[model samples]
Target chain A: MNPSARQPVRATTSINGMIITVASGKGGTGKTMVAASLALSLAAAYPQQPPLYLDCDVEAPNAHLFLHPTLAEQQEVGLLIPAVDEAKCTHCGKCAEICQYHAIAVLGKKTLVFPQLCHGCGSCTALCPEGAITEVLDRMGIVERGSAAAGIAFARGVLDVGEPMAVPVIRQLKKWALPRPGQVVIRDAPPGTSCPVVETIRGSDYLLLVTEPTPFGLHDLRLAAQVAKELNIPTGVIVNRENGTYPEIDAFCEADHLPILLRIPFERAIAEGVARGKTLVDIHPEYGDRFRQMFLQIYETISHS
Target chain B: MKILLTATSPSIDSNVDPRYGRGAYFIVVDPDTMEWQAHPNPGIGASGGAGSLAAQFASNQQASSVVSGDFGPNAYNALQAAGIAMYLFGSSATVKEAIENFKAGLLESVGAPTGPGHHQH
Candidate 1:
């Protein structure tokens, strides 16, 4: 028997339910690859309670390329933008005064509202003295839900091209695809440690940070790690295309106390397969068991901590 | 008519600020009387929508014309809607020089936005 094939120690207790978010500080660091593989492995391990894969990278959702889920349901997501009623407005400049985004401005007799700049915070509407401000739904994106291989539940949010904010779309996606009890959830978060990434990883039980063993990867990983620390979430690192050339990543991880959960060595065949819309598990069937073992380890670590 | 000039400092002798949205100061002056009042720009440190905020300030100050090196789309639209003329001045010119050029009709009126809308952070 191969030493790598040895079975990993499984947790004695049930996980009940857990949300594992896969994120990266830099783009093209294999976040979707790890997320899809984990979902596939989890679904295979627990066929009775398959995992749900949510692509929260609304601005550039690409998990569907691997899972190819048949999206049978779709819902439009929007933000409520302020609409000023001129008849009731006194031109007192109160609405503009309260808007932090500067989306609304009272220019003399005209009240100008820039819908694209609005964050949908509703502060303007609530602060309008004459009750002239009303909120109207402005469509920004859409959320789609369906199932993939092994009956893995899949959902993804797609933001409209040129949309400024992706937080609203991600928020609506999570609300639309509420996971059931005892069901595992794998969220594919967007790249960068900004508001969109924060919105996706907010309520997760565990965060799996994916990165390559490169200078850019290490730089962004540090920033992403800061966000994880700030959010107080238990995080693990997965190094993709690992060639052992960059020991700095490991050193930083060891110093930061962020456990290195998995390291996927660089391979030409894997890259070619992934380029053709194949998941890591699909290219390497044995990785399915490996992913399951990683999941169990995460559960055990989180439970203990 | 009061001419609003984007300035680097609160004085007319200061160099003209190239950026209209993130201008350091706004010096409103009557070109005929040379009477002026300088106000620190409120939009200089804004995270976003600085152009719109600066435009709103210009309208609130009742400036009939604006002089800057470049005008962003939001500022251009608001100023055009408010019927305030936009004139482009060289960065080398001082606030007083830009205002003088506007009165002499030597400055070019910008028919469209000279720069992109949002600031890249």
Candidate 2:
């Protein structure tokens, strides 16, 4: 059954439970696919109490293609940037000096503002000795809330094109979708070990790190592992295409004492399904049970730890 | 009119700093009197936006024109908007020579920024 055809999912009826964030050290490691499938399976098992699926990868959010949520509400996200009051101005050049992004430039009496380059840190406004600067809201992106089948409450952030910052939208998304007690929250964090990934996974109870058994994968996986360690978040590995003799990633996991939660073998059909925007679980219902079992393991680990 | 020239040394004999935003020092001089002061370029170590900061410095110093080897896009726009003419001074040109060139109308006027921003780092 198509998820959108179902009734609205009750996202916050439960208690203070774990927020599971699914992240990868590198891109294209099936991060979104796994997160989506896991959310779908959890929703299926808990029909009355659905999980919350948050696509925190604002730059390139694609989980909605598989979830097919019917977005019932949409809201715009913005950042507070500086706008100058020119009439009362002395050409102090202080605003330009204070702005690290150099968003403000004072050429004699001419003040040029580069809105695109502004990080909206308010440094210019705060340090403006003449008080010529005031804070203004600039649209960053949009956040949409919807419900998919199996009672999953879905929320995703779509960043504005050419926007470098992703944390604000992610912050707003998390604030909008507060986790309920005993209810599962699965976040599809952006790839890489950058600030965006760190921001998304910071407060999560458990981090499901996805990787492949290869040299590049293992290298980035180590970096991701280190981030989880630094954040003090308990983490496990889910190696994609695990049917391989590549012992590097396995050895690293063994050495690191990280649990291998679940593995999907090297299957062309799964890739083909993903290419068509159909998740592996959608193509092969059996994988749904596999993801559910993995969730159980994660839950046990979270509970015990 | 006061003119700003990027310099590596405090004196006019110093070679022109080829960089605009990241220049080590900015020398503001009156071409006729040759009166000048060299101030440290605060934008040199800036993570980004050095160009704009440098341009703003030129305006605050009351410079009608600026001479630099290179200008980033941000610097070009700021200087241009301020109605300050920008001239290109090669590495071989000394600060004294650049001032003379500006007075002699021999310096090449730059309407556009020379290269991408942050290329120095």
Candidate 3:
């Protein structure tokens, strides 16, 4: 395989606007908490330059749960799929033969079109000599925008629960969530280093990978770190639930000379706050201070480099 | 067997036109004959990596292999499952060029076709 073809698109980190991603390898690692608090903390520290919070975890998007932004705008994200015209189609099995997605199948006199495999690319129709195929847009999901209580510009993408693709919805949300000049953007990415996570962090200037102090955390942290390193984005570790668990994160950072931005200790209040859909910065203001410190350290590092 | 091409497209005009679908086309080619066909994706139920419903459609076609401009993870996986091999084109060339490349044996196979019906929907 050609190396360049498989290579991921490089994200530009020189832009003054910062994109800090809150990502964890495993679920329930307080990734969302760290992401939300970072935004709130940044807003409080630089009230004039409040941060914009984007919840890219379309699978179980909960940034809205914490920020609870009033719905300002909502619209459906769509993907184009092919529909067969029986009148024009001879069921010559040509469409099925040409379909790379296997979305079109001709059986006897009838044919079935699978709506999910369609990438909306027009190769099939163009190849059809009979002109039996047409394209149609299908609503994939909804992207919502609003303002949070803290005046943080809020955006979240919710892929229809069954929809397999989150990138399209994320792409749409990102279009609206582009960092305005001088605005710090905090993105709470989906768990795991998958396509959705890649899409969430694609244009980020900096990534704040939030992992816990556990064996699983370490394992998933490695995966998350690999993703960050693959993207060549400058990243730091923010250890959440820093209780009596593995300290390997610190060792990993020290060994790699990676900066340990900040650590949020395990606390019941944080859990309760999350359960209540309340921002931890509001639930417990002290955590906000630590988050601000984390943000400042990241800034200083970026400035130095 | 005469080759057929399939893709997901939402517009009839676009299926025939080469400009839409981001220039991505699904080409099903008979490996032996190299004769092929094309279809544009309609973009429905096509989400979530390649879906199971899509595998069913491919199984129905008994497609030997699929060639396309791009494959989202879902579609990629779904196609693999249906006992169909997936080949990525060498460049953003036209469907005609892709066919030529495939016939000339210039393209590369990404992976063996995956198990069918892996997609839930």
Candidate 4:
């Protein structure tokens, strides 16, 4: 292992539960494909465990595209927005001055409000000496939870289109799928190493960074690795599309001393299966055995480390 | 005297207990002297508005100043009332470096970091 690359491992009591975060630094790295596939595999491997699938990719949540979960329950995710009572007309600009997100703006005897920027932390409401600032719930997104046909409990957040932030939606989705002992939860994280990605992988037991063998993939893998390191989480790499090219990936891993856990060879069947909205393990039973073995390898690594 | 240098960890590095929208880390430093002390961040991942979470930490420690990467207005105002000083760490710099820069008086007070389209409820 590279001396600088060797991270300090802080061991804690093994909680039979795992929060597997599937992420890629670059876009179009098939993060969702691998995340969804593993969730399905685990559900089949340990049927009694009752694994929950959480899609933390709020910006563009598409795990539902593969999981096809029925809408058993649905609700809006709301944040507290500041409301100004015009009747108590004193445009003192106190609320605007107190707003951190710039959600409130003041002009000559008039104030404008933007509900989207409001974090609902209730600072404006408290700071408003005029008693004009109050809180009103503004819908941010929706959390939908239900069971897929394959017996996986799936929960995902669909942020309202045009919404720039995804953390609120991701947080709500997590609440929907609270982790339970003896049962595992798998999270399909969003692409990129931004705030949304961090939110998704924050509480994970182990992070599985899925990457392809390309320049873009290597760059993103490195970034995601740093993020994992900063969070002090154990990380492993899954090489997707392994057949074509991987010299750069191998070199990077060798230099970083990162463990390469599993590699999925590029196959027409996998591509076709994905295009058809079917899992590779489902289309080819042989791959099912391979994924089962992969799961075993993961379990062994977690057990030892 | 306890001098709390309030900070926020990236949402991903945050943990439970500090129930903020984004994750918050409380650096309980020695007052008048900038010596390192305990970091009260439970290390649970969190996301969303940090006003309540930041308030929880400030209230508990009676913080004097907040050295954060970025803070919304709501969180900033709350910390101010709690007698906590708030500074922005928007750049790719360390908390210590930012503090040093601020003390050297090289930092400009940007007031609050929140702008349109970036605010949360």
* Winner by DockQ: 1
RMSD of each: 4.4, 6.0, 14.1, 14.3
**TM-score-superior candidate, 1 or 3:** 1
Report the CAPRI category for model 1: medium
Badly placed stretches (over 4 Å) of model 1 are: A1-15, B119-121
Candidate achieving the largest lDDT: 1
Quote the B-chain TM-score, candidate 2.
0.93
Task: Encode model 4's per-residue lDDT on A1-305: one tens digit a residue.
Answer: 11332233232122246677888898877788887777777677666665688888877888888889897888898787878887774867667556655456553444556565566788877877778877888887899888885688888888998776688889888876676654567888888888889989898777888999988899999999999999977788889888766688988887876778778888888888888888766776666556656655565565566
Predict model 2's lDDT versus the native.
0.83
Say which candidate scores most in TM-score: 1
Model 3 per-residue lDDT at A19: 71
Docking quality (DockQ) for each candidate: 0.57, 0.47, 0.05, 0.02
Better of 2 and 4 by TM-score: 2
Native-to-model Cα distance after best TM-score fit, residue A167 in candidate 2, in Å: 1.9
**Over 4 Å off in model 2, which ranges?**
A1-16, A93-101, A121-131, A243-245, B1-19, B22-40, B67-73, B87-108, B112-121
Native contacts retained by model 1, as a fraction? 0.47
**Quick one: ranking by TM-score, best first?**
1, 2, 3, 4
Evaluated at residue A148, the lDDT of candidate 3 is: 85
**Worst lDDT window (10 residues) for model 2 chain A?**
A1-10
Per residue, candidate 2 scores C-alpha lDDT tens digits across B2-120 of 99988897778899999889899999998889999999998888877788888888888888999999998888888889888999985347999888877888888997889876622
Interface RMSD over true interface Cα atoms for each candidate: 2.0, 3.7, 7.4, 9.8
Tens digits of per-residue lDDT, candidate 2, A206-291, equal 99999998888899999999999999998999999887878888889999989998888888988899999988778789988888
Residues A117-230, candidate 1: write the lDDT tens digits. 788899999988899989999999999999998999999999999777899999999999988777788999999999999999999989999999999999999999999999
